[model samples]
Target: MTHSSTAPTDLPVMLPATYRGPDALGYCRWLAAMPVWALPVMAGLVLIWPTLVHAQTVYSTEKIMGIMAKWLPLLITKGFSMNVVISFFTMLLGTIAGLLLGVGRVSDNRYIRGFSWLVVQLFRNSPWLVLLFIVMLTLPFEIRVAGTYFSVPDWMKAVFGLSLPIMANIAEIVRGAIQSVPSAQWEAAESLAFTRRQILWQIILPQCFKRMIPPWMNWYAIMTMATPLVSLLGVTELVTLSRQAMEAEGNNPSLLVPFYGFALIIFFAYCYPIARLTMRLEKKFAVKG
Candidate 1:
């Protein structure tokens, strides 16, 4: 009878006894138990790395990673920066429009209330991409006034497109926040010789500010994510610039993962902290019954 040097022939012989990795069957079982999206996502990166390294075409002295590193910062400067600008302006415009629409929703005048509700429902239900196309195509690129031409930039159109949905959403947020204030507050303010406008501006709206904030931040994050859609409009955002970089590099198939991967990383980096902060604020501001 022969003694085995390794009882576990399937496992790594060099690994220390305490840290020997899982055997193939155990690893397969573990993978099977993971969520549906988890395996594919893990596999996409893991499977692609070695394949690209072996197959990557060396057009310049630079390797795939170095070329990617050079462009990553460029992506930030030339591309993702525009995305941030669009998101900021979109949020600002939407907040203002939404405030007016929300006020209208609560207006005593039936006409104002009906108009606000109609605008909200229409924009809220429409697809964002459709809105973007509508706005971009319908608006003139430039208009002349007094022999001077002012052009509407594609990024501005993106802002308008994004703002429509945001405005509709924020209007709902405002309406809900305003209504969440007790009717007693309104009645009490009315009894104190306050006009309807005074009751809203002085008493109800002040209380609603905290309630509106978490959702406003949430929507801002969402609008940031959606800014990538503007790339379709040829608005020079991250994805569009990434494609341009790839083309300049002779469109190596291998660069797809690194370029898009870095973009994914940057977008994730920007949005994830906002999401965490959103959760914390929600918990912090949650009202007790």
Candidate 2:
């Protein structure tokens, strides 16, 4: 205590208030630079682990092969055609409905706007499964358009049921995108003496379309996956074919796993490339904030 030395009271000295250790600094940099491989690895593990753990010990090679042979032919013939037709019709109807609702959402007319809001609220708030059931099983039985009576074949009804909800969702997306375009753009179109239709189709719609493509692509992919739901309504689509194959397997429950799994794999294989393309389009069209 007696030998202790003290600096002058007024002297300034610099000392670090805090230190970021090298390990901490390196960790932040590592995280920033990390590759995106981890997520895919995790997803693959999650998808594969259940199958591996639950696979039956008494695997019949003939049963597996026979199921594959029977399913593959039908899948290539009827299943493929039905999927393509359903997807096309759904996309067509959804696009038209979305465009009209989107325009109505931004309309100056109160009636049009209110009606659009009501449609969106009614459809969007309901569960898609419920909507499908109503359209397929209940609507035709309950509601008649005229003395002529409107009826849809079960296949067409399935398409309509699946598509209507999707269209409602898409309408909101399109409306939002259109509204997001600068107000100045609308004013410019007006100043140029463009009619409302001209302004919308020429200036706003095109720009909105670029913005809309990503979401539309994603929705299309979802719709493609959802084609299986058509089977519930007696549409002899892919899932229906697979179900029939499973029944043909008779008492062997083990075949159920492979049959369904193979069907799922087949659908995934068809849709995966489309999903990848959509992702690429999303990246390409992403607007800078």
Which portions of model 1 show Cα errors greater than 4 Å? 1-53, 56-62, 144-147, 287-289
Which TM-score value belongs to model 2? Answer: 0.74
lDDT of 1 at 52: 52
Q: Write the per-residue lDDT of candidate 2 for residues 100-182, one digit (tens) a residue.
A: 99789888899999999889888865877778888887656434666666656677777788888778877887898889899
User: Tens digits of per-residue lDDT for model 1 on 189-245?
Assistant: 888999999888888888888778767887887789789998998999999999999
TM-score for each candidate, following the candidate numbering: 0.80, 0.74
Top candidate when judged by TM-score against the true structure: 1
Provide the global lDDT of candidate 2 against the true structure. 0.70
- Model 1 TM-score is 0.80
Identify the candidate with maximal lDDT.
1
